[model samples]
Target: MMTKWERLAHELRLKEYTHLIVGPGASFAYLTGMTAHVSERLTLFGMNADGHAALLLPKLEASGVPRSLQIHVYTYSDELGPVEALKAFASDLGVHQDSRVGIESGHMRIFEEHALRQVGITHLVSADEVPMALRLIKDSHEVALLQSAAQIVDAALTSTLPLLKVGMTELEVAAELEYQMRKLGSEGTPFGTIVGSGPRGALPHGGPTTKQIEQGELVVLDYGALIAGYAADTTRTIAFGEPSIEARKVYDVVLLAQETAVDGVVAGITAEDVDELARTVITEAGYGDYFTHRTGHGLGLDVHEYPSIMKGNPLVLTPGMVFTIEPGIYLPERFGVRIEDDIVITEDSAQVLTQFTKDLLIVGD
Candidate 1:
């Protein structure tokens, strides 16, 4: 079997790319097995089809880089900018204005691009496909890590749910949940823990706020945990005390949508099919206009990856693929309902990794 670097080189050759540059981010970490701090200081890993590989980073990080990589290293200092280091690395690899350089478009900042241009490295194109192609499938070890992460999140939320009270602030609930995750062996949160209560739940991506939880309100708790490098994202909506009739109705719709979406997950189905399963349910229930955002997104080393479960996505599902099944209904200036769960696609069926009960939960004192 060819190594990861060998596979990357083969891809570069196939695409006729002169060099593939990855930033000090997830792709870099995924490929090199070394996680570097992302800061203002420039850090990059450049490789070509000919098998030559090099890392250009700050002097402070030089010692930490593993010699096991057997790649050329170029270091820069704070007194001098990163352009000279980039130039030296680019020069050795014969990168120039005409070179077909590929970059991680989502991660590499504009300043990094400017620095690349300064070093005579132009003709940069989006290289998202190269890395994502390899990352889309989950291997055995990766699946194990993801399963562990899901367990951590499930346990944390279960523990935190009972502690919630009617008067507790959203921030307090978020903090307690995170604390429980830590106690259960999570290194950190993959994303900000969301505790949107009442009308605040209308914001799908809302983070925790100081607003106190009130009786008869809906609280949307969207959170995730990072175990090792894998992530597990899930959401659960709970009632503070006695939820309004409208809130209960919305929650049932969202729950049915989510369950239907998860049940539809099978090998060979397109991502769009999975999305439609949930969308059709919500749309038929008359909350179609309020059902904002995609049905779900891929989950792995990064919280969001390729093969998003949304409309018009023709990506086919296969065994070992993992993603979230989150369908939501958010009413403007009113409460919202979202139910999410992580699932892994198997040969015959999709396994729901998050074991938490999806019953319309009523929490808080």
Candidate 2:
């Protein structure tokens, strides 16, 4: 566990990055299992190609860093500032202007970049891929966290769906759903809970609104639960009552696409091929144009990760890889439908981690 950064350091050396600096975010927590508090203070996890690493943090946050990031801990007081500590960090690590430093482009802020520059390290590069490549594969611990997150989300969505009422506002539904998740033991939400109702469902990422849900309209409930820094994304579209024939037909198409895509997931298959499995179904059903967005995305420490399940991405699926298989279709100004499930690639096949039933449900009547 403490040696995780050793792998990243080796990758950096292969890429000729003499040192790698990570900031406080999912990437940081991925390595440390500790979330660094970031405000105006400068805190960083630095690793050199020699596999030596240290943490430079505010004195207040120093105690919280784990041993993984504590091989050499340097602290700066609020009054003294981080400059002096940073100087010593660079000097001890033998980092200089010529050292090829890399930073987490995904999470490192501009101010953090300037701080690194102030330390005389000139060859700073964006090496986000170096660590993400390691994170792409799920270890036993990460898989357990993801599975637990899915279980909590499943329970929350299952319990909350029956509470949706026709006249209930989308915000009301979202609130109930989120509250259930918390009561069921989720740490927090990975992203904003989406409760798009009726025509609002046409907006893929549209959030909950004050608009009231209506009878005979489709409601898109896209949500997830976060646990131990891992998250699961699941979306289910339900009809308040009997939906229009057109809406029903569209929903069926999306369901077919989503299920087929998930079933096709297997080790050695390309990510784009899995995407094609779903896209082809929708396209042949004459609803391809309405199906926007990629088939799905990788899910883990962050809501989105590597091995994008989209057209043109040739990333090969492997055992222990987890991602979402969500195919959606939005008929503008009408109702939309999306069915999503979290999937894990097995040795020869795949398993759907999210146990939420994808069947079209008639509810909120």
Candidate 3:
């Protein structure tokens, strides 16, 4: 079992920091097994070079700290201003003028950084890059949790498919999908559900609208489910009736492109190379300009994280790293098609996490 102290030690080495300061993200959760309800009151996990760790939080939230943390906990009453209390707490923890602190730049507020400075701590550095690099390679426990999340998303999409039909508004279908995901034990949708019918499908991030699904129109459903802080992203394009020849051609290109991209993912391959494989396929099909957005992005605690699959991202792929492979082709004011699946890289090959059928499904009178 990985103890909090052990996790902290790993982070210290990964970040090459004398001390670590964490906020309310996976880094904090992974190390302490506690969720910080970040707000006006600052919550932090601080660890020194010698592996000694401590937590500082608002007095009211102290009870929520897990017993497994096995670290010194300091809290400040609401009566005392949080900043003042934090300063005193830092003093007690021996954080002084010469302390080198690592802070999460992505989640740490500007004022909080200023406060740390006022308290006599100098040499603060961004710790996000280090943790992000570490998180790219998932441990066995994280992979198991991610697989479970993918299954939940797969079931939710399957159950919601039967509700699709001509005349149903895109917003209605989106609502039904959300309801199914919740009923299937997903904590919530990883992001806003996207339901695009016909021309709206061309917009990758198109939010659900009141436009009704028409016969022969291609509908794009892009969504994911959040389970225990992990996320799964998938997309499927289905038609209410027989698709036009043009739609089918575009869909086929996207499917082929996505397959090529997934095949490119392997241990030691650069993330950019994986994206190029898909882009090359789409370009050869004469739809390169139509296919926008990166091939994929790393997924875990946040829907989007490090090691993005885009041109120029030189991060090398490694076993246990998970991300999405989505290739899309859109025609303005006409229609679009996309096929996406989550993939986790292995020593020899990539494992597809999302198992929902990508085959074009036609449903209508």
Candidate 4:
């Protein structure tokens, strides 16, 4: 764990800004080692260039700030109004009318930005871009946490397989999977559990519904777990019984596409190049339109982060950067096949984090 002062100094050097403004996301947690519930009220962390930091919070939440931060805390009463409180705190903290401040634009609401400007912070720059660049490279401890989260997800999926027999509703399957993940010590799922069967399976972001599973249908299971503030994502397509030739063909093609994309993931390669490897395979299989959405996305404190694998992204792969490589072909009004795996770029090659079997599993009766 990095010290608050150390992290603040690092950000100042990397972005060449005098101060860092943190919000209520992983960035805040990473910088201060504090996790406070997000609310309409603004929670800001201002770290100056001198390695000194201050926290601005509501009076109600002032007590919630961790004792380890060892920084000055300014609190505003709800009755006093947030803007007035913010202005007073900024004045007390010596924020001048022309200080070069770095703000997280992604998390800062327009109203909040306006309030900051009202407080004489005119030379504000976006801190999100540079901070995200720093976050893209994970340390060994972060990798271990992600690996543990992946193991928990694998165990949950493995335990839920027996409950996926014929006649089970898609919603029921999803509920069972979530329950198993919680039982296996996962805090919660990173995203909604996808338990699409038959035609619903064709929808990439389909949620579990009341549709019942039947024989000779395809089922797509895409789920993940949040463990220790880290996230893991994986997907696998299985057959309820003996799948039709068309379904089998599509599955094989999608599997091949995913493998090709994974093969293309190596250190120094661009994210777009990796995506093209999968896109080319699916397009050659004559399912170009069916393959909607990007090839993959980065996963960590947030389910989605930087270094997206898509057609236009030019981020270069590097060791310690983790992401998902999910390739799918969705046939309208029929079914869809998706194979996803979590991969972390290493020095030599890509390391697959999820250890579950990718071979199509066929359940019967």
Candidate 5:
């Protein structure tokens, strides 16, 4: 009964891969439940074909490794330098000059790559596929964690919505939302808390600012909470006082598109098809250009994962895959409307994890 990682190692060996190296990121946290910070110091998780695992970390961080992994750890101090330690660890893992090793190109530093080359391991290739394949499907335990994180954020959003005022600055709303999330037991925010009001909402990646929220404007709250290393992302648009007819039309169209996309999350559907469904809905309403970004992105240990929901990507939907279904319409020089929710594919259909109300909220002055 080998674990998923152990089975991955066995498969890599059959494929002639000598070792798969991982740095501190979602993949490392997924493989090992222990969270380690990515820093200037070198820390790596190496797995061999025989399911043997090793950790090369700073001497101070050695204690962070969980006892359950049973991984061999090699530590180096500042005085000794990390190159020699990497050499010894590579030898211990049986990586040689001709060994076909796999490394995470994005996370592994050039310093470590050069160190491996110096130590005679020259056949290093990208190992991103191995972990991506393993992480796309969420196990029961992982699903539970994701759901729990979603619940925490939903509760926080529900509680904070009432505290939003016409005079409150976007930054103030963001701070209040974060406070509620932490009070509800979230470890921290997955990304920067977004509270874009009025015309700022038109900017997809807009952050909170000192500008005060005004009446008759649409405010977008796009935020998430992190718990147990899993993340939850959700977005909802609130209308302070009565919004303009144009803003109302945008909100209604976007809401319909978002709901339609969520209902389209059945097994066997292509990710592109889902994106197309939402795009068609908005496009038919004459706001296609306003729907600028992709339909959505996958989520789990990392906020953005695999199986991107966008046109031109042929990835099929499968059970155990979790992602967000967010469709937005941003009208430049005006306001924007976005509705987002976390969803996980079931055997036959999909389950929405975030329970926040998607109905347009009209708050009075």
Candidate 6:
């Protein structure tokens, strides 16, 4: 099997790209296999088809690079500018005056691009599809990391629910869950923990707030953990007490939608088809308009990656592809219910990575 960098070099050669630039993000981590804190600083790694690569970092960050990779390391001090360092690294990589460099358009900074332009490299194009395709399929090792991360969050959620109280704020619950995730061995969280309760649950991405949890309301806990650079995302909606008839009905519909979608995960299925399956369930439940957002999204190095599970997407599912199956129903001013699970496609069917029981939980009884 070709190494990730070697495969990237092959892509560069095939695309006739003279160089490939990656900045800090999942794309950077995917290519380099080394995690670097993302900042405004001009740290970067440049690669070419000739198997030549160069690393330019702030002097203090130079030591973080692995000693095994034989790439040229160019360090810049606070006194010396990053522009000169970029020039030196560009020369080391043999990026010519007219080199057609490829960059991750989403993550590359304008200053970084200007540095390349100043260093005599001319043409630059987006190589966004390269990493998107390369990282879409998870290898066994990647799967294991995702599975371990999912297990940690599942265990944490299982242990944290019993601690919920009626008067606690949404932020408090989020903090406690994060604490449990960390205690269960997660290196970090994939994103800001969301603990939307009561009417706020209608907001799809409503982050945790200081609003107190009240009785007879639904709380949506949307969060995930990151381990070994891979991520696991899941959402579970629970009631603080006996919710209204409408709330319980919506919860049942969302749960059914989530389960149906998860069951439809198999190799060769179109992403849109999986999405429609869930959407159909919600529509038949008389909450079609309430089912906002895509049914799910791919989860990996970053929380949201390629292969979005939504209507009109043509991407076909395949073994090793993993994503979330979160179907939600949000009735404004009433409540919202979203049940999510991480799903991995197999040779014949799908493997649900998240082990949390999706059955509705009634807390603070």
Q: After superposition, how far is residue 215 of candidate 3 from its true place, in Å?
A: 2.5
The lDDT values for all models are 0.89, 0.88, 0.83, 0.85, 0.88, 0.88
Q: Please, what is the TM-score per model?
A: 0.96, 0.96, 0.92, 0.91, 0.96, 0.97
Clashing pairs in 5: none
Candidate 2 per-residue C-alpha lDDT over 170-237 given as tens digits, one digit per residue, 9 for 90 to 100: 99999998999999999889999998888899999999989988989999999999888899999999
Error of 1 at 279 (Å): 0.6
* Candidate 5 C-alpha lDDT tens digits along 198-224: 999999889999999998989999999
Stretches off by above 4 angstroms in model 3 are: 1-16
Model 5 superposed RMSD (Cα): 1.5
For candidate 6, report its TM-score. Answer: 0.97
Error of 1 at 215 (Å): 0.6
Query: Under the 3 Å rule for N, CA and C atoms, how many clashes does model 5 have?
Result: 0
Writing each residue's lDDT as its tens digit, candidate 1 over 1-365 gives 77788888888888888889988777888888788777888888889878788989899888888778888899989999787888889987778778899898998899779888887787999988888877888888899999999999999988988898899999999999999999999989989999999999999999998999998899999999987778999999999898988888889999999989998899999999999999999999999999879999999989998779999999999998999999999998889889999989988999999989988888775
Across 201-276, the per-residue lDDT of candidate 3 in tens digits comes to 9999999999999999999899888877788888999999998998998888998898888877788999999999
For model 2, the stretches where C-alpha displacement exceeds 4 angstroms are 67-70
Off by over 4 Å in 6: none
Q: Could you tell which candidate, 2 or 6, scores higher by lDDT?
A: 6
Please report how far candidate 3 places residue 359 from its true position, in Å: 0.7
Q: Choose 3 or 5, whichever is better by lDDT.
A: 5
Residue 335 accuracy (lDDT) in model 5: 83
* Ranking 5 against 6 by TM-score, winner: 6
Model 4 residue runs over 4 Å out of place are 1-16, 81-85, 114-125
In every candidate, how many clashes are there?
A: 0, 0, 0, 0, 0, 0
